[model samples]
Target: MAGLRPTRQRIALAELLFSGDHRHVSAEALHGEAGAGGIEVSLATVYNTLHQFRRAGLLREVTVDAARSYFDTDTSDHHHFFVEDEQRVIDIPADSIVIQGLPDAPNGMEVTHVDVVVRVKKV
Candidate 1:
């Protein structure tokens, strides 16, 4: 949100992403929703905007699956529950996790941060 101006389309997309409730959304899904809502944004624009939001720290990408990327608006230091069956990502509270030492990098690079995503199937 720092360098990005809130354009009409961006604001509308942001409203759809953030204003309602906390949830994960893919660019294609968002584009479909926007189209249903009568917004004239293109799919490529949605994907670009989503990536821009990720770069700006307004959204976090959930990378459980490489083929599709899910966007999250909750930028806090928390984990996620990725339901493989439903293709949903839900926040796991930060306080609920405890961390030990992380595995060392092969290149001796210091670990900047760790994101834990627990994938589960709904029974």
Candidate 2:
């Protein structure tokens, strides 16, 4: 529905993605799921599909660090909490935080969105 071609692979991936409640998933994890679910798809294909989905606004990419990122199904305006120990992501209550800043956008550029990822480790 995000203006992407409904290819067989995309359809399968979309089913896996949107079947349950909104969640976060990494490419590797999704590739593994597809593999286990008897879907003959390659890792590269999964990555490409994810990027395509993101470009089509079907997913939101949340980069937790330089090496790890996850695709979030919920696209609403909200931040996330990255569980460091579990390597998972969850939404932070939208009303629980407030942000104030003192910076202006660069010439000809406008601030589009702000992403806040709070990392919490096991106590």
Candidate 3:
């Protein structure tokens, strides 16, 4: 946790993310929660912290949409289920999913990661 210093805002954000069961939340949603909890943090700060956390490997990014991004505390390799209509994200547990070899890497290129975001709409 060297890189992950628990700033007041970060601590509050972590509490929001980890304190009450696991969840996948977007920056806007987190900002709203922080506001409700009386934590004064701007939406940009929330986004910056999320990006920093992701870079520090403390959180994972779920590409749910171009305009909005979801954050996951579970950093392990896995997939996600994104409900477009509901604007919700849920984890696809590691044990419940599997991945075969990835497609061949282009010449002189390597596959750093493979993120699978399964988008679905409620019926």
Candidate 4:
């Protein structure tokens, strides 16, 4: 699902993101995957394409830390289980959690959405 014209690089990135089941991936990981798949694309291009896709409502970005973010192929409302050891994210069903008593937003601004990332560590 692309809002702009299908450029070659965009098409390639889209294939990597959407060709399989819904999942999350970082730009660095996706760059590696593209290389392994014989698709030559720069890391910068991957980041740009991911942001573009997010802006176009084709993907959702989950920020795990200030230095790391994962682009989720599932754009629907859902929480996540971030496994620290594996460095992977798995979907937590949207209906499994409920939010309550949210304070009002500032004037002229609205809450677009809320993301819940529950960190986990294997014992």
lDDT tens string, model 3, 15-105?
Answer: 7877866678889999999999999999999999889888987788888768778898788878899888888888876667677977999
Per-residue alpha-carbon lDDT of candidate 4 for residues 5-56, written as tens digits (9 for 90 to 100): 7988899989989999999999999999999999999999999999999999
Name the candidate that leads on TM-score: 4
- The per-residue C-alpha lDDT of model 2 at residue 62 equals 95
| TM-score (all chains, Cα) for each model | 0.85, 0.95, 0.84, 0.95
Q: List the residue pairs that clash in candidate 2.
A: none
Residues 1-123 of candidate 2: C-alpha lDDT, one tens digit per residue: 688889989998999999999999999999999999999899999999999999998899999999999999998888999999999999986677787884899999999778899999988
Output the better candidate (1/2) by lDDT. Answer: 2
- Find the 10 residues in a row with the least total lDDT in model 1: 105-114
Q: How many steric overlaps are in each model, in order?
A: 0, 0, 0, 0
lDDT of 3: 0.84
Clashes of 2: 0
Question: How far is 38's C-alpha from truth in model 3 (Å)?
Answer: 0.7
Considering lDDT, which of the candidate structures 1 and 4 is the better prediction for this target? Answer: 4
lDDT ranking from best candidate downward: 4, 2, 1, 3
Expressed as tens digits, the lDDT of each residue in 16-51 for candidate 1 is: 898876778999999999999999999999999999
Model 4, residue 16: C-alpha shift (Å): 1.1
What Cα-based lDDT does every candidate model obtain? 0.87, 0.92, 0.84, 0.93
